[model samples]
Target: MVDVSAITYDALRVAAEHVLAKVREGEELGTEDIFILYLGTIVNELRDVRSEVARLEDKIDKTSQRIDETNKRIDELAKSLSARIDDTNKRMDETAKSLSARIDETNKRIDETNRRIDEVVKSLSARVDDLAKRIDALQTTLLEIQKLLIELVRSRQ
Candidate 1:
């Protein structure tokens, strides 16, 4: 009878192999040998389960590593995009400042042009007034000469 107590997996495997060899030699297998064979089958199935579990763990580790790498790439892209946006904003601000300065310069030129136009208008108006006064004086002198000529002609008649 095989000692069931304190039987390690290696001892059980050796006993099972011995029993298989005896059975192949046409020797009758006792009940204890059959039981050892059954236990060996259970141990082998457990080993296969452990191997499958390890394989799955390795695959999961690889997937996790890939996920971490992808996250890092996303972070880098975000940083690059943020920097580009900041640069664009800075350029826009500079352009706005330049345009404001140009607008101010244009307004100053417009103000100067208006002042010159006003001066020219005033000068022309003063000259027109002086000419009108001279024309009135000439009309009055002509009327007085006409009256003196009529008086002289009447005295001679």
Candidate 2:
């Protein structure tokens, strides 16, 4: 009727080109979807990393507080121990003084006892000398009586 074969061929060629263009557009859309997915994944990772960092920072702060508390406790304990040691030293000093006084008193008593012993020894030595002198006098009187008896006997013979 109006050259139907040429018109049909031209229409088929146009439809084929439209199909190819649509396929290309679909490929581009697929690539854009993949890119968006990748960007979302990166954003999620960054958020997770930030959350982890915040948690770590909180933990560090808590640890620092705990360390400070421990140090304060240690300081308090050291001060308490030092006070106790000072009290003990004071008591020890008093005890040492008491012991020294007792030792000094003991030494004084010992010196007094020695003096008494020396006095007693001098009295005994004097008594011993008086007894020796009396013994010598009695021996001399016995010898004189013996000599008188011998003279009387000779006169009678």
Candidate 3:
């Protein structure tokens, strides 16, 4: 009976040791599950960051294209403005030439009018001198006639 009890006690101790090992293995599996969960969360965050970076890069590319288009438009506008300025300068030069020609023509007409006026004044002066000479001759003739008439009358009386 004593040997049988010793054998039984040994068997019971072995069984308790096996159950404790199983419990330890279950704890290790729970820790491994928690670790896997943390790893999955980290991977998900990295993927989100990569997607955001790609979006930002696309926006930057679009902005660069818009800037290039704006530069091209500005260059075209500058060229147009330069051409308009050149045309305006040409018109101004033409106007100045026309005005100068007209002024020259007006000056020539004024000179001709002054010359004609001078000739008319000279002709009027000459006519006035001739009339004065004729009046003097007529007066002398009248005095001679009156003297002849008086002599004839005296002789008749």
Number of the top lDDT candidate: 1
Q: What is the lDDT of candidate 3?
A: 0.77
Q: Residue 83 in candidate 3 has what lDDT?
A: 97
lDDT accuracy of residue 73 in candidate 3: 96
Provide the lDDT at 101 for model 2.
100
Query: Each model's RMSD to truth, in Å?
Result: 5.6, 16.9, 18.1
Lowest-lDDT window of 10 residues in candidate 1?
2-11
User: What is the TM-score (0 to 1) of candidate 1?
Assistant: 0.63
Give the per-residue lDDT of model 1 (tens digit) for 1-157: 8766446876887898899999899998888988988888998898899899999999999999999999999999999999999999999999999999999999999999999999998998998888888888888888888888899899799
Which residue pairs in candidate 2 have backbone atoms (N, alpha carbon, C) closer than 3 angstroms, thus clashing? none
lDDT of 1: 0.91
lDDT of all the models against the reference? 0.91, 0.81, 0.77
The digit string of per-residue lDDT tens for model 3 on 121-154 reads: 8888788778777877778777777778788888
Give the lDDT of residue 103 in candidate 3.
92
Q: Model 2, 42: alpha-carbon shift in Å? A: 3.2
Q: Compute each candidate's TM-score over C-alphas.
A: 0.63, 0.67, 0.51
